[model samples]
Target: MTAPDWAESALALLVHRAGGTAAQVGSRFPLYADPDDGRWTTTGRGSWTGGFWAGLLWLRARHRAGLGAADLLAASACTARLAPWARADTATRGLILWYGTALAVADPGADALRARAARAALDAWDPRLGLVPWGAALGGERLRARADGVPGLVPLLTSAGPTGARAAGAHLRRHLELCLPGAGGRPRPSWRYDTTAARWAEDTEPGPGWTRGEAWLLLAVADALLRVGTLEGSPTRPPNDLAEAAEQLLESGEFLTGPLVPPADTRRPAGPPDTSAAAIAAVALRKLALVPAAPWAAACATRSDTVLRHLADTRLTRPTHPAGGRPGGMLLDGCYDPAGHTAPSHELIWGDFFLALALAALRGDVDLTRV
Candidate 1:
């Protein structure tokens, strides 16, 4: 089959699956679903994953635009549901606010929501810390930095203005300097600030081989690389910092080259693979491919297409059932947390979002660079 043949089918499956998920979850947000029965573990407040649900809805609305207006209305309602997260102190407001609103074009509500999130994030920024501290709104260390805090933030902060651009630059640079070591070393996924010592200490939870950590930080670097020229103020970091960060992440992400899907943690090679990480990396690579004149642009694009194809062939479920039943389109083998044995192999909401996004990009229904 051709690229579009598989991509279109996969996209359709994912969107259909999103419709079923919407019907079942209603107001709640899905985190991960059981691989066997398609039963979801839901959250009332949408947590950090809520935006991905909204994003999938927007994709479905765009995909079925002429079919009916219901999907669009559903997407809008879901975006509105994400409003309260704007005031949450977590740096993941980028994940919640930016993604929750980015794809909804000409939406006044989404526009207002994005603006509100940008300002909230700007206010949350700690100038002394040189970045938005990994916030405590979700219950964790308020002065720590994690790889998950950076991706959606780049665009969210840049939308605020030059000050925000500077903050965005500093945020990415600070995380890169601390989490990723020099000379192409492996990445550490988390760091906490020790006030007594006034320095950053590496957290042991995520370990060195956390697959999602590498993918998340790479996505952030790709975002920065695409917007390199916009950070114009006194410059917390060099302009080339973005490119350097991308290069480091590309070198460190081994799954980008092989296995397509990787273990939840590379430290345990025999563990279940996290298709979510691969999906995220595929989107990031597609974004990187859009960076003009980059030496690796062609390579990134090819690898991205290959990764998406591999997932479509292997991970994405087929749409053989009707919409009312346990419809297909679950992107399985997504390891939420291997150490804690939490949903070690299931269908993740973000996994579904990225897989749908990549397939939509392939079929020309959406722009990978923008969303």
Candidate 2:
């Protein structure tokens, strides 16, 4: 009946899926589950989404139902295993570290691992680009950047205290500059500064304005701004101007509730509706309302509630797998473009994670932004 009830359901399902997923895929990092066949794919620590399983466990155990000692140990093991990824060349180090380091900071045993990850992020700074390189190639020929990197990257950087503040500030500024300008300097989600070609290129999706990328960039910026406000003892650089941050929150809120009601991969009518994007936007908007300079807070809150209602229904939600190992996958019809081909449109792990997070925020389970 209420958001908490849905979150409670999701919490139970997460635990069920965690146990079964561990049995099915073991500790090798369950990256994805085939929506139709229910086969799990393991990508080890290299995959960006790999941390979500451990993240889900931590969120379920810490925020929702408490896990048993054995499960907590398993979750802790996953965090320890991810330590090597701190030195990984990609921008997703934050994605890998967020849940783990958040857990680490809470559980005093993880201090060294947290410090290691902080150094990895510190090493990612590319002064030429004024931010960390988006692609793993780094100083190599291919120079790439992405909107998705910020949401996952910034938190880990901020969590490092003053050590990461200067770099985090630089990254956010570069990210905004890279937001390809539409008519009248409106920010699009992504663009490429082709260092090799010496020209700027627009980063596109199925069509103009990748809805998910836009949501990630804009909402993530707002989330970053929110973090700058609430950080107690940690030293974090203040993000872009308050007016600029407000503009981003306003733009994101407007786009999310715009004509493309159930936002798809692209804003186009023909584009496949990505319920995952909508879910991400829902959490972003809800969290956006909490930030200092954000306007239309009540309106944004209303839109996020509407989005969650849809996600809670049969349309975006898929039933738990008949056999097991998958449960209450919240947002359906997700689009992921891997190098070789487009991954199937199914429930994205981050989608489910954010949707549950949104519900948690709405029901006062977790502080979505500050965490």
What TM value does model 2 have?
Answer: 0.83
Indicate the worst ten consecutive residues by lDDT in candidate 2: 230-239
lDDT tens digits, residue span 1-371, model 1: 23478788888889888988998899999999998779899999999999999999999988887887788889999999999999998999999888889989558999999999999999999988889988998897899999999989988999999899999989988999898865656799899999999999999988788989999998998888777778654323335667777877888877356578988888899998999999999999999888877777899999999999999899887755555455589999999888899999999999999988888877777876666
- Per-residue error for 133 in candidate 2, Å, reads 1.0
Task: Give candidate 1's whole-model lDDT.
Answer: 0.87
User: lDDT of each model, Cα atoms only?
Assistant: 0.87, 0.62
Per-model RMSD to reference: 2.6, 4.0
Off by over 4 Å in 2: 1-3, 63-67, 103-105, 109-111, 137-142, 184-187, 196-199, 203-207, 229-254, 259-264, 315-327, 338-341
Segments of candidate 1 deviating more than 4 angstroms? 1-3, 232-238, 320-326
- What TM-scores do the predictions have? 0.95, 0.83
Q: Against the true structure, whose TM-score is highest? A: 1
Clashes of each: 0, 0
Candidate 2, 273-368: lDDT as tens digits: 666677778877777677654555677778787777766764343455455534444345666552223544665666666676676666565767
Candidate 2 residue pairs in backbone clash: none
